[model samples]
Target: MYSTSTQKREWTYTPEKLAAVRLETNIKFREKYESVITPEELELFVTPEEELRMQRSIEDAALKFADKFRPHIWPSVKWTALAFFKRAFLVWMVMMGCFYLAMKIDEFYITIDDFVKNMNVGDPRQNAERILKLEPELMKVLNYNLTVHCPYRPFEGHLMDMKTRMLLLNFDLESIRRDSMRFFQNALQTDVLLVYPPSQIALAAINFGCMLKSDEILREFLRKMIGIEEDSWSARDVRPEDLEKLEKTVTRVNHIMREVEKQFVAVTEQERENHKSRLSQIQNLLPILNERRKEAWRAGGCIGQEPGLVTEAPVDSDDE
Candidate 1:
């Protein structure tokens, strides 16, 4: 039989108590992660009233400038056919320039020859990185995505939810947003999107992106997402499997993106020549490595020394 206090404690979880607990949990969740960009706001193409006000202000300023210029230029025939023709000519010039660019795009396409060392590479991760690192002018050729999922949407959603809180925390929100989005973009540049769920991939991106911007905030922000108290969020306490997955995902992300970053960093002609010079100076190190291996084997007794080197010529029973 249970003690009276035990029975009372077990029965203490009443309907009202359960309701209150659930409500409290909901409130806590909202405090930590309520989406700052609501669904309606997301759906709107332009909801920020400030943007509209800015546009209107610009238009009003332009009109006021025109009105002021009109009287001063009126004596110079401001409304003359020559002025109208000048406007038309400028518009035609812009149109023709645009048309020429469109037609001669191939001639103007930006390129850096042979970014990837192996063109015939079959690794999906490597291949994807190659495509992503291809000249930005090649973006039009690569626009249509065939990946199983676009992680950008999910990542943007997650970022929208936490952006305000991150700002309040004195983080450089713009840097975080930019880098995090780039990380997500890089994840798509590899087979990582296929290997991991977009959300998990995004979590990995958030981890790395935070590191790139401000290493200190990564753990603290992750703890906020996990809804744990500051002291209770020690990273070392995470389960081994979970930690391994997170670490592996971040490792793969960094590897894939590092190559993409190389494209942005200029490789000067001198540097290229120096690289070639280093290659020419390089001898086949395989033989040296092999010799070291053999020496290690001999040291470990895995390989025998020269014949009779470590042994007596004979074990003379008479001597013994």
Candidate 2:
């Protein structure tokens, strides 16, 4: 089912490809304004890495924002909101807007006025208008494909499997479930969602949970799951290639967890303020730069042909 899903078909990317795409976007943004703006002004634009860091902070803030709602937002809806926010190329200003759209798509409707009032941001009316105006752009960016398959479901499945299949460990499954879910939550802060399957991520969460409980138990569980015998390299039922792939997936997920631990710190208020100012400056300058681009294109005769004028004929235009 996952293999046939749109996420696997269209949204997934390897780390190198993901980094390359980000770098290309970074370069493209710089090129867009390079000729129009001064070098000092150009330096103010954030790099792809900086943008990612800011996004991570925004993600945490978005979760906090959702907590303000009166009736609790569904966990699935929150997951979908986070997915939309990550997929849509957005800044801090539109973070709430994206989440609002996610809630709508997920059929968890909240009135705009109520939403804005709860947000407690500047100008409730303006916030409502901004959210409405940006809705179309977010939909366009997502290609109107709203389905997001999160790891939570598969996570539960894996837990069920472990409870029944790997009985020898005799560990308390309920105790690790909370930690597994926590690790899964932390996975969102990294690129693992884009780079790996949800099922693999769920298993990785289990691996982390087990590792925390006991490394020896973790190893035994992995050996059994991967079908590796104590005396030989051969697997029991899992294909050699499949086993290799699973090993790599688990290793990469663990690596991402470690990296996130080292790199993702709680975003400070001052840093967020600076990010907002920088984003605001960039937004203010984009229009001027775009107009200059258009002017240059027109001057160079590079503009496309304008729509041809319609002419009246013997037959009525409407009839044709």
Q: Which candidate achieves the best lDDT against the true structure?
A: 2
Instruction: Tell me the whole-model lDDT of each prediction, alpha carbons only.
Output: 0.38, 0.71
- lDDT (Cα, tens digit) per residue for candidate 1, span 54-165: 2223223322333354113221121111222112221111111221122223132322222122223356466445445532323122121111233455666667766754
TM-scores for every candidate against the unseen true structure:
0.28, 0.79
Question: What clash pairs does model 1 have?
Answer: none
Q: How would you encode candidate 2's per-residue C-alpha lDDT over 166-259 as one tens digit per residue?
A: 6776668778877776776676667777778887777777777887677565445556666666566445644677567656765766776675
Q: Which stretches of candidate 2 lie over 4 Å from their true place?
A: 90-93, 166-171, 216-253, 291-302, 305-320
